[model samples]
Target chain A: MTSSNNTDTRLMTGNEACAEAALVAGMRFFAGYPITPSSEIAEVLARKLPSSGGVFIQMEDEIGSIAAIIGASLAGVKAMTATSGPGFSLMQENIGYAAMTEVPVVIVNVQRGGPSTGLPTLPSQSDVMQARWGTHGDHPVIAVVPSTVYETFVWTIKAFNFSEQYRVPVIVLLDEIIAHINEKITIPAHDELAIIDRTLSSQPPESYLPYKNTPSGVPLFAGFGTGYRYHVTGLCHDETGFPSSNARIVEELYLRLNRKIDQHRNDIIEYQTLDLDDAEICIVAYGSSARSAQRAVRIARQDGIKVGLFKPFVLWPFPGEELAELTRKAKTIIVPEMNLGQIAHEVSCATRKDVVSVNRVDGTLITPQEIVKRIYDVQV
Target chain B: MSFRYEIRLSGSGGQGLILAGKILAEAAAIYDNKNATQSQSYGPEARGGSSRSEVIISDEEIDYPKAVNIDFLLCFTQEACDKYCVDIKEKGILLVDSDYVTKVPEGKFTVHKVPITTIAEKQAGKSLVANIVALGIITGLTGIVSKKAVESAVLSRVPKGTEDLNTKAFNLGIDLARELK
Candidate 1:
């Protein structure tokens, strides 16, 4: 039924939206073992995907889960896997391989307090840096941090698009708070949403260089069984799918797989600016914590304290340059994260402004009051 | 110019606060045609710690889905009640499991002395259904939703095998809550 007004909604969690986005993005396969805060995605997909003519498999472990999604993607299907911290760590090896082999796969890391299973239910945005450097060796990654369930829905589609277009693993960085937070969300009809198809290998089976570069810097990917017989390997290869040790070839080839996402930073970056045009203070946050910070901005505004919020939806590429520029205008900058100054360090580098961190390690969202208090505390 | 209302249900994890909020939000959104959202805490160690679900319902598109000023508060443990009592909005409704909670100080809200566990055990003959009874009571007290919505939502939600027992527990809750109202 159509909503009475545009505001009508049905209650849903961030995990549910991730699953719905995958389905709406034309994801046909899922392979994941349930993990805390992120388990519901696999569970819901298990029940929902089969009915939608998709395949869902609970793999032996996170590694296998990611491996299966890679295979599924090669077989001409959009695929994804979900995990929390420990599981995220386990899948890193495969995630690196997805980057190397240029497989279009999306990984959902619903972060909890972690070094190793530190707090399973507690929320933490510590994975902000992990999404970038956690995969090992130079790799350009596309990761999106959603502030709300609605943004979660939209970013999931964007994540899949980047994975398919750039031919690499894209991370949808979620946390315990957003992953499990249920909210009323409206899902636009299938026609209203955009679905991305992978850049297929059009070369004849024998003539295919799976790594052939296009003008846009992304090599055309060969979905398996498309009559394009080619080899795929973890080893740095030449313009071909074959393993190559040529120093120049490996350097250039490895650089481009990353450059394909890096160079298109414009298309790769997704962020939101709230009250940024005129504000004396700025709060930088992502995921569920950003939602609370937005409220803090409104509260601060009501108190005649001019404040703005900068939420980098694209967590990895991190609008560092953007923040550097914002630091020029905004007098005080406060970064509130579920972790102790994870993304703040990046903000510190990007902006010359004295970045103040309002850390929350209690496994709960950093409240608006705490943010407001931090904003004023810095000035006073 | 609509106010976004976020109701947080806090208690030790596995106390069914998450599912209770889910049922409440579902009843409000699906049954009553209102916008609602709920989120819970998760961790390997969260089972015995304070866990909460926050639901936001509004007549307009909810720009922020997190709770700000609480309209209803439910706590099953002393810590939860102690943690949230001060922040509850004026004239808000507070439902505490009186058996587990003792020495509750009066607040600016309406405090109900519902022995939810006792009612569930005595009436429905199962403690698991205490949440359902609480649901029925809240629905009746608020008058914002019809019992049919919750009934349909719960029936649509219960696992395949245990549907009948859940319905019985729900009806018992409705009766109890209606009597209180």
Candidate 2:
């Protein structure tokens, strides 16, 4: 599965890797605004996409950027957009629109410090919740966070796959650190990658229901100008693709949208674990924090501290079951994140245990020494 | 060999030190089969602002990407040397560009002064290749990465038609470092 025709290793930033992976994943349309820490993704695609016959358009603003991608996705092309904190905030309404319409699109949010324009050049994992709930409504969300440049490439491909698979907009959450840092990665051949396209309705135009319910709860999507004249809107709609004000129809529409992802949680959830077999203390982290936690776990094990690490790459549809099973045997759980205990609260509720949160919102990374010191304190 | 070797290249933003750091890291990781990570910090200004790039090459996977205990520091400007000298590990190797950086701050690290800008201008006919010259000197002085590997990485990154000039500058840097020893 890992085999490739062209295995040349190149040094690239995480943002560059994301752009390259999107192209490899059959993304032919890119619409984005230039934002610090995330603008490189757009810059690279701007130069590279044209040579590959892909269209790269820098929209007027972030809102237009996301809206353009949604429109392109509806036209039967894999599309994406990239932005930072402030830009991400502006794209939320369009993101929610994509969610309600079940348009398959990928959004790359290279996160920075924020409630509003806090720090543009610095890194922070503060947008984890925003990624899950930034958009309005109760629609299901799928967001993948990558810690390394290599994983950034791999997960960007997965982001497109998941979006097309579940008919939802997928978010790739990147902090400023990983988005800007350069590292070596071996890019596999095009033939070696598992590229997925959206499933099209096989039924004729007369019987083609754009929002027809299925066993998987994921409706078959038909592109515009493809002989399927179906209405698409952000409003709640029935199975026939028309807006329905009926309470029962609206309830079923929302429930099916949520169930489409919930029922397929096993396929969407991805995580990494280390030394949890006989450990008494566990450090749960994600994004760039997971890198430091890996070092902390290694150092703690060398000192016989019985500490381990649980890193969730898929932040949304939160891996509650996996965390629950890992935390059941551990005595103490420590969560370290860039924001002030954003994901820590989720860990506590999932495990039904006391979780110690080591948070840093000062735009500096939490070091391994800080996590190690906290582990020693918990031991006492 | 040590488990990890951290290198820092500091200078003005236009000195191309960030590209130098990337080449060094790629040489170690792609050619030498070591794990490496490269990161940079610069001010808002594109040029003339203080800039520094760090590369950490390790035998194992890099946990924290940033360099904490720098084993080698190459400073092309006085301000960069003064601002980042304290972060170098005690008894580490510090290389400076003698043409631009006149004053060498007193530190526990061993200092080697070389006219990198002059060498690039006089010998390579272009000062833009000074960063590549510094890469050659660092690889020659410390032997952290193979000369063949650095050359391959350099040729891969340098612009299409400037390979001959960059290679000449790199070789001259290696010769100068050898003479200093």
Candidate 3:
């Protein structure tokens, strides 16, 4: 891939992978700060966007970064930002604002082990729940986790799609393992890729209700400078985006926001289930750990034990319905993550079955043999 | 009987391990008409860190994106050798760059330490082709890949003028491996 793809695959890191995804997706603006495990995204975009007729700014902090992206998005530009764990926490206020304003922006969080700078170089999937509930209020976030470098290319494109289609924030949850892993992935030309453009409202300024929902429950947002003078605010707003404490309006708007995610469960949920048709035990993992589970299943099968794997590609929508369906066939479910049983809680809640969690807190990957031993230890 | 082998190439950041894996995986999938996938993980700083690439080449479709353990382990540095030596499956070959790496592990499977660096310096006039030389040794030891397929990948991917130099380095590795007993 070293230049044969028309653009040189010139030794790209995971950070570069995200930035390139944004560039090809027609993003015109980028605002991000330098943070460990994710700074490369900023560095690459700083150099690459200008030649493509785009703007890349190194903001003073993560707050400024999120603010800049929202500003750009509101002005009819495709905007993006990248951050790590703590920086993501800092950007939540503006993220909420982007939600309330119905702005389409892409936020990439390349996670490292952290309550705060815990392990910068190591890999961890501890932020699965935080991605869903981090930003303030009841607003939705489309969080996609990519396990391998090849996937970074695919999910980055999905990030742009979810952001545009929903008119809200879309998060790409890439961990340190994949963010730094350098690999060869053949990216097809734009013609071969199916890219979704932002949904724009055609209604005139006077008739526009800023919060009006389509049948799909997502509002087709018109950018600010496009003559749509609809009001927007941080407070709970009515149809025209004016603050309203009215019971009926608030109730309807709140249900529609949540239902937007629920109705598109099939489209939003991405996962791979292997050998569950005849397995006594199953492993539920995401991101880098999913790679380990894949190998463990193959090895376990070779050893005469029927083992299978379930890997969640789209993490935020939770893929709860699929897990519920899978529960009836399997006897036990093993959830392995970089942190101490983060995603396991979700598996237990969704499956309602006794779920076993193989936890690792030190920031290294959970090995395949470890998962296999868990299956044998909890044998039927 | 088909084999499911994940070949991992590990070394410093500039060793072209990722490129080697790409060429090998493409050779398997495109040229050999087998299923193949390549994945990599690196450090923050591009150069002078441990860089590893995983390649899954199979006669059937590949189900997993990650490589658990490797069948062929190529290490160009002591750090990489120390790291990946024990992780390989039993009876798998461990190919180390002898000119750069001197220490060899006493293990069950044959550990071939070829002077890949010296060979590349003599042939290609630089250490850039050391990776190609080691790749040649890899193909010679494991008969899963073909000489024509790898040469095609190298000739196609390398610079226009440097093709002959790299080809010379690759053939030197093929010859050096046969010279190894």
**Deviation (Å) of B106 in candidate 2:** 3.4
Candidate 3 lDDT, A11-86, residue by residue in tens: 3446777888888788989998888788888888888899989999988999999999998987888999999988
DockQ for each numbered candidate: 0.49, 0.47, 0.21
Q: Estimate candidate 1's alpha-carbon lDDT, on a 0 to 1 scale.
A: 0.81
How accurate locally, in lDDT, is each candidate? 0.81, 0.90, 0.80
Better of 1 and 3 by DockQ: 1
**TM-scores of the models, in the given order?**
0.91, 0.95, 0.83
Top candidate by DockQ: 1
When just chain B is superposed on the true chain B, each candidate scores a TM-score of 0.91, 0.96, 0.94
How does residue A360 of candidate 1 score in lDDT? 85
Question: Tens digits of per-residue lDDT for model 1 on A71-108?
Answer: 99888899999999999999988899988988899999
RMSD of candidates 1 onward, in order: 3.0, 2.5, 4.1
- What does TM-score give for chain A of every model? 0.96, 0.97, 0.95
* Candidate 2 residue-wise lDDT at B65: 84
